[model samples]
Target: MTYDRCLATLKAISGREAASGYSQRALKQVFGTSKVTFPLSYDRQEFFSKSVEYSKGISISGVQEKLSLRLDRASNELVVTRNNGEYILKPSPEAFPNAAENEHAAMLASQKIGIETALCTLVPFKTGELAYLTRRFDRLESGDKRPQEDLLQIGGLPPKAKYDVSYEKAGELVDQATGGKRAVKLDLFRRVLFAYAIGNNDLHTKNLSLQRAVESSSRFYDKLTPNYDVLFVQAFDNTKEGQFMACDLLTDPETGEEEFTEPYQEYGFYTGYDFLELGRRYGLPERAVIRAIRNQVDSQGDMIELIQSSYMPEEMKREAEVIVVGRCRAISTGIDR
Candidate 1:
C-alpha cells in the first residue's frame, strides 16, 4: 500500500521518504495533491457501472469510459462523482489494451516539447490495472467553474458535426477568441504541427477548447485551454490508415466528379507543406512554423526517454518510438523542401 519509488521521477509517491517526489508545491498547484495514489478502492467493475450510470447526466463525450472525481482532502481519497471534481480518470479500454499507458506517455511527450498540456499521471488500480489521471483545468482555486467552449461549439457546429471541419477552422476560432493576437495564432500553428508530428489523428473539435478567465468582464474574451486528449492513435490502432489525419489542413476544392476520392488525398499524409499552408492562412510566418517543427524534432531523445519510463508494455514502447521517430523524419524532410 506504499510506493517507495515514483513511476515518474523515481522517488517516493508518499510516506516520510517522499522528499524527492513530484514537487509538493507544484503538485498541489496542478493536481491539488502531492499524494500520487488515489485513496480509494480500485474496483474496476463498480467504477465502470457507476460511470455508465453517471454518463446519463454528466456525460464526457468520447468513446472511452471516463469518470469525474473529487479529492476528499480530509480523507485523501477520490470519490466517483461529479460534485465539483478536480480530475478526470480514464481506465484502460477493453477494446484498446494499454490505452491508459499510451495516453499517459503521449501527454508526457507533449509536455516535454513545451506544449501547455493537461497535467496527467498514471495510477495503479487495486486490480493491478493502470488508469490515466488528468487534472481538470476548467475549475478555479476558489472552486468556481470557468466558462469554456470547445472548437465545435465556438465554430457554431453541433456536437454531431465535430469531425466535419478542417483544422484551419480551429485557427479561425483561436483568432476570434484572442482577437487576432499573432502570438496565440503562431502557438496554435505549433500545436497543429505538433499533432501531425506525433501522429495524433484524433485532434477533433472537442479535444480543443477555449477557457474564459474567471474575472474577465467581457464574455467574448477567452484563451486556449491546455492541450488534452492527445494520443498517437496510429501507433496503437493497426486498422488506422497510415496517412490519416483528424482534420484537413485546408479545404479541398470541389472537383464535382462523381468518382470516389479518399479523404485528404491531395495533401496525402499531412506533410510540412500542409502545416506551412495552415500557418500562412493564419498569418504566421513559414519560418516560425518550421522552427516549431524543428524544435519538437530536436526533443526526440527526451520524448523517447519519457516513453521508456512510462507504464506501457515494452512492445508498445518500441512501437511508439518508431512512430514518433518516423514522423519526425518525415516532417523534417518535407519542411526542408
Candidate 2:
C-alpha cells in the first residue's frame, strides 16, 4: 500500500481514504484544524520571487533557504507574511537534493524514538515540489508570543561562533537554565544520542533552545523546546568529513583539550562507551542512560522502515539507511564498521 505524503501512514486510516493526500492525524498535527483542504497558492517559483523579502522576517539561520508564512484559515491557504508568521517554509536549496524529504523523515524518526519535536510535515508547492513546513511552537493560538532563547544567546556567544562550543558545555547550560532539573537533562542526553544515531552533524548551539512556559504555576518556567532543524546531513555528498559529531563530546576543564575515549582513538569515531561516559559525567541515572541507549539501538528496524517509506529518492533513501544503520551499530557496539 502507498503511504500518505503528510505522515507516511497507510493511505487508508481505518476505512476512510485520505482525499487531501494527508492522513487525518497529520492534518491535526500540522494545521491543528480539521479542514482537509488546506493548500498553498504559491509555488516554488513564486517563492523565489519573494524569498529575500520574506526571509528578512525570519530569525533563525541555517544552510536551507526559508520563508516566513502564515496560514489564512478563511482562504484555506498559506500566505507569505512579513511579521507574526506562524509557520516556517523551507524549500530544497539548489545544492541539497530532496532536503524536504530528508528533514521530514528525520523529524518523523525522532518522534518514533520518543524525542519531542515541533509539528512538521511535507507540503507541496503549487508546482508539486515538496517543501518542509514546521509550525512555530513559540506562537500561541491566542496570538501571544512566548519568550524563547537559543543556547548561543544563553551562552552569550555571537551567531558566527555557534560552532565554537562543545556539547558538554551545552549540557551544562541546560542544567543551569532549568535549575539542575534531571528530566530536562535526560532529554538533553537523548537528543545528543539521537543526533549521533542519525549522523546529523548540525546540532549546533543555535539549533537547541528553551522556551518560557506560558503558565506561571508550572514547576519550571524555562523548559527545553521541542526538537527542530533535524536532518541527516551526513547523507549528502558534500559532507564527507570524518567527524561523527558537530561539536566535541567533551573537553578537559583545565587543559582545554578535546578528550576522547580509548575506543574513540582506536575506532576513529565515537562508540557506545563515549556516550555512556558522557551520561555518567552529566550525572544521569544508570538505568536512564542504559534505557536511552537501548532505545536508540532498538530503533534500527523502525527507522529503516520509516526511511524506506519516506519521500526521499531511491538513491537518497539508501544513503540515509546506510548512514543510520552504521551509526546505530557504532552506538550499539564499539565497532565502527
Candidate 3:
C-alpha cells in the first residue's frame, strides 16, 4: 500500500496496511488494541514532566527517552501502567530533529535487505506528535520473558566496555553461540556489510543480542536476535570522522603484517574487499560474499522505493538515497577489482 502519515492509512508495524486505520483485527495481530494514547494535550514542558514521572521505575537503557506501554484494547489507547509492556515507545528526542522518523526508515531498510529487524511503526500521540513504536522481541506471547543477552554480556564485558571489541570479534562470539555454524557466521557477515553500506556506525556490542525460548531445555541453543536501534547516523551528522565504525573490521595496514588489528581503520570507508576479507575470516565462501553485494546492487531500486514511501522528510529521504546509492556503487566497483 502507499505510504501515508495517517495511522489508519499508514503501514502497520508488521509492514502491512491497516486499511481500516488500526482496526481491531489489525491491532490484535500486530499491536494489541488496548494500546493507550499518550497524554497528548500536555504542552512540551508538561509532556516531559509526565514522561519522566511515568518512566520512574521502568529501566530500559538508552540515550533517548523511551517508556514501556501496554495496550488497553478496550479503550484503543496505550497506558503507562507498571504491567509487563509488550511494546516500547520512543518519542522524538528534543535534541534531535526527526529522530523517530529516521529510525523507522532505517529499520524498514534493514528488513528490505533480508535482515530480520525489529518490527516498528510511526504512531501519533494524542497531542498529534508522531512517535516510533517497536514490539519487544524479548517478550513472548504467553507473557514470559525470553532469555536474551547482548554481545557485550555474551562476551563477558560490561556496558562500559561495549567499544572494547571489534565487529570481527563479535562474529567470534556469534560462532561460539551457534557452535561454529557457518550459516550464523554468514548471517553476521551480511549484517555487518549491510550496516556499513547504510552508514550505521553505531552498531556497538549492546545493539546485538542472542535470544532463546525460556521454555527450551537446551541452554546452548540461543540464536541471534532481530536487529534493533539501527539508524543512518552518518547522514545526519556533519563530522563523520569518528572512526566510521563502532569496531574495527580489518587489520591495520601500517604494521605491514597480514594479521588484522583491534580498532582497525587503515582504509577510510569500508570497501567490498573489507567485507570479502571479513567473510573469508569467518569461513564464508568468497563467491557468496560477492553474490550478496551484487544482490544488493540489483535491489537498489527496491530500496529507493521504500525510502520514497517512508515517513522521513523529503530532504532526509534524498540524503539517505544518495548515501545508500553511493555506498552500493562503491561496493560494486571495489568488488570488480
Q: Arrange candidates, best TM-score first.
A: 2, 1, 3
How well does candidate 1 match the true structure in TM-score terms?
0.85
For model 2, the superposed segments whose C-alpha errors exceed 4 Å read: 1-19, 36-39, 57-62, 217-221, 334-337
Instruction: Indicate whether candidate 2 or candidate 3 has the larger TM-score.
Output: 2
| lDDT of every model, 2 decimals | 0.71, 0.79, 0.69
Model 1 misplacement above 4 A: 1-5, 8-30, 35-39, 56-61, 253-268
Ranking by lDDT: 2, 1, 3
The positional error of residue 81 in candidate 3, measured at the CA in angstroms, is 2.7
TM-score, each model? 0.85, 0.91, 0.83
Clash pairs of candidate 2? none
Candidate 1 lDDT at 84 equals: 80
lDDT of 3 at 165: 69
Better structure of 2 and 3 per lDDT: 2
Please report how far candidate 3 places residue 16 from its true position, in Å. 16
The top-ranked prediction according to TM-score is 2
Consecutive 10-residue window with the lowest summed lDDT within model 3: 1-10
